[model samples]
Target: MAESNKNGATARLRNYFLAGVLITAPISITFWLTWRVITFIDDRITPIIPPQWNPESYLPFGVPGLGLIVALVALTLIGFLAAGYLGRVTMRIGERIVARVPVIRSVYSWTKQVFETVLSQSSAAFREVVLIEYPRPGCWAVGFITGTTVGEVQRLTAATVYNVFVPATPNPTTGFLLFVPKEDVHHLDLTVEEGIKLVISGGIVVPDQANFEGAEVDAAAKAQVAAQSDRAENVEGNGRKRRRRKQTQEPRSPGFITRLRNYFFAGILVTAPIAITVWLAWEFVAFVDGTVTPYIPAPWNPETYLPFSIPGLGVVIVVLGLIMIGFLTAGFVGRSLVSASERLLARMPVIRSLYSAVKQIFETVLKEQSRAFREVILFEYPRKNCWALGFITGPAEGGIQELTPDDTVNVFLPTTPNPTSGFLLFLPRRETQILSMTVEEGIKMVVSGGIVTPPDREVGDAAEPEESTPAPLAKSG
Candidate 1:
């Protein structure tokens, strides 16, 4: 009895341990990630910031986190300006000036275009998530649809166009972008978050509830069989010849060893979900810590809070704080910061070049939050038959079209697996079919390389048709 009690206690303790591990890992990992990103930004600022003006000089604390604060304030002020009319005028003036400068103008406008596409609310880019086939046959991935094909190519050759982004497995941020025709790309039923989880797990995670239900049904059926056998045995012992005859007619009862094996296996099937969940969660925590924690300074040791840190708390707090400041700058505190940054950057010649380059990229990509990567679509490119993912930006407007004497639309085509690079093609509108899919779906398909096929009407095709009710002809008469 004592041995049995001890074993029970050990089992309970193990369960408790597993539960704790499952809960705390995600929180600690998030904090570690936030800290690492902050530190990286500080490292970049450290080399450029003079020792006297540096926030570190004034603080006794190890590596000040105020640079992140500065970035937040700056962003907020920029948001405020961008939201208002005066800000637009200033931005236009800056654009006009940049356009006049030869080398700087080319780099500035290109960088600006990318940012505008991504940040502007009108850009409508990366709005929808999708699935696509990727890497090899039978493999699928999640992606987003950015936009459509554009430019003189459209006048020359009318085609239905799309831009698909196929995200990398385990890392959705990096992936391929294929511009294909609208007809070839199919939409998936899975949500972006679910798709990401599937990719990261490499298809190991199954979400079908039917499997569990079926297992339950099988177990219940086996239980019913055992119950029937018990009743038959009882009847035989209770009565005489008739009962003995009835028992003989029934099938043979299962052996004790076989019954025991079935029961044990059933128990395992029931607990397998909980066991696997605990194991995966533990592994996830370990992986995040291994990847992000080492980059953090020793002083912020996350292990101290082990088993509980508030999941994604770091990301939540930091992002919220930044956004809040942005909201405030849209009011007042934000404006002052932007003016200061602009003035400071404008004063130095060499610093101006570097600052402008980085600032331009940030403004276009992160500042205005343009609609560059709004819709993901499939666009046929290079030839009549092939297709790839392309983002639909605005219609092309340039002197090149005036020179061509033919109507043309412009489109930017991004490279796949690494969206940062790709071809820029001009194609006609008639050839392109605007997809029913949202921008997010197109990206997943592109990034996944066509692996993640989104569910369609066919998934429900197995269900039997229901009988229709007879028409009320008698009432009409």
Candidate 2:
């Protein structure tokens, strides 16, 4: 009886320890990560200040977040300068210099455009969350409305289409672009942040159903039923067809070995996504550390003074360097230097052509006025009865529009699973059907291969036809 009591006490103690860990682990980890980021920024930025100007130099101890404040002030000052006429001229001169460098032009142009688009307040990159039926009529998935289809795509179809971005589970960064019909897409009340959380958590962190005010329960039920019936019919038909081919053949049950193998594979499917995500994050940090640490001067390097090596200091230094360069480039003297460098690069023969082509491509894609990949659409490809997903790149340019007597648009039809590689199609305005779903939903469909579907809604008689553009759905603020 004494031994039993002792064992129970030990078990209770173990449980208490586990409970403490459960409660404290998340909070501890969160603060640790935050501290690391703050420390990295502070270490990189603090050294740039002169000893007399530095707060740490006079203070008894170092202060946290001081470097972050300094960085913010520096950026604000740079922006104030860039808003002036001299800053504008300086920026233009610097751009010209970068444009003349063959290899550096491509990198700088793309990087600049990406920053502008992401940072622009007016740009609608991923604002409106939505739902769309993808792969087939019954299946649905969440999407983000990028913008409306424009140029040749709108003219050829004679209808408006929405550009949808469909992000995949686990990794929402990589996904497909789908052009869905405007009336067909069901707008969701959930915010983009909520949608991203749902996707990253693989539906575990679902948004409240009550928030989906526009969702039609009856329509979703009917669509789900229809989908199940269609799947059942297809399975039944396939079974019958297979039976007809061999009269005496009967389906055999799987052996123990086969069952074991299947279970093992199923286990792998459950674990692979999580494993890959963690591994990729670690590799990215390691790569940044490996590449950036070598460039750091020994005297200024954090590792020189510290007993242990810091992984993210190099990344912090790179960020600070970019900010400093932006600050310097906005000034008058920097503009003169940039102009001189540009002239030197322009004198080079073979490098100029390569630089020009790359610079032009970046300008076209990054320009706020450009409508490339802004809208999504659907059209018959190869032949009738077979539909293909595509993004409206822009109006047919060069000799293509002139060569074709009828109005035509350029559509990029991305391949399934991998959206980066796809066919480019030129079709008439009457041939395509524009969709309302966001590009994000379309991407998820392509990545998931029809497994992740959007919510469904009833298409009433009042629904707009393929030829007509539907009215925009009211979006939540």
* Best of the candidates, lDDT: 2
Q: lDDT for each of the candidates?
A: 0.52, 0.64
Q: What is the TM-score of each candidate against the true structure?
A: 0.39, 0.46
**272-372 per-residue lDDT for model 2 (tens digits):** 33344445556777888889998899998879899999977767888898899878889999888878877776888988777778887787777999877
After superposing candidate 1, which stretches have Cα over 4 Å from the reference? 1-14, 42-64, 79-107, 133-140, 152-159, 188-197, 203-386, 389-477
User: What TM-score would you give candidate 2 relative to the actual structure?
Assistant: 0.46
lDDT of 1 by residue, 292-338 (tens): 55555546656556666544434444566689888978976679898
> How many clashes (backbone N, Cα, C below 3 Å) per candidate?
107, 30
- Deviation from native of the Cα of residue 321 in model 1, angstroms: 50
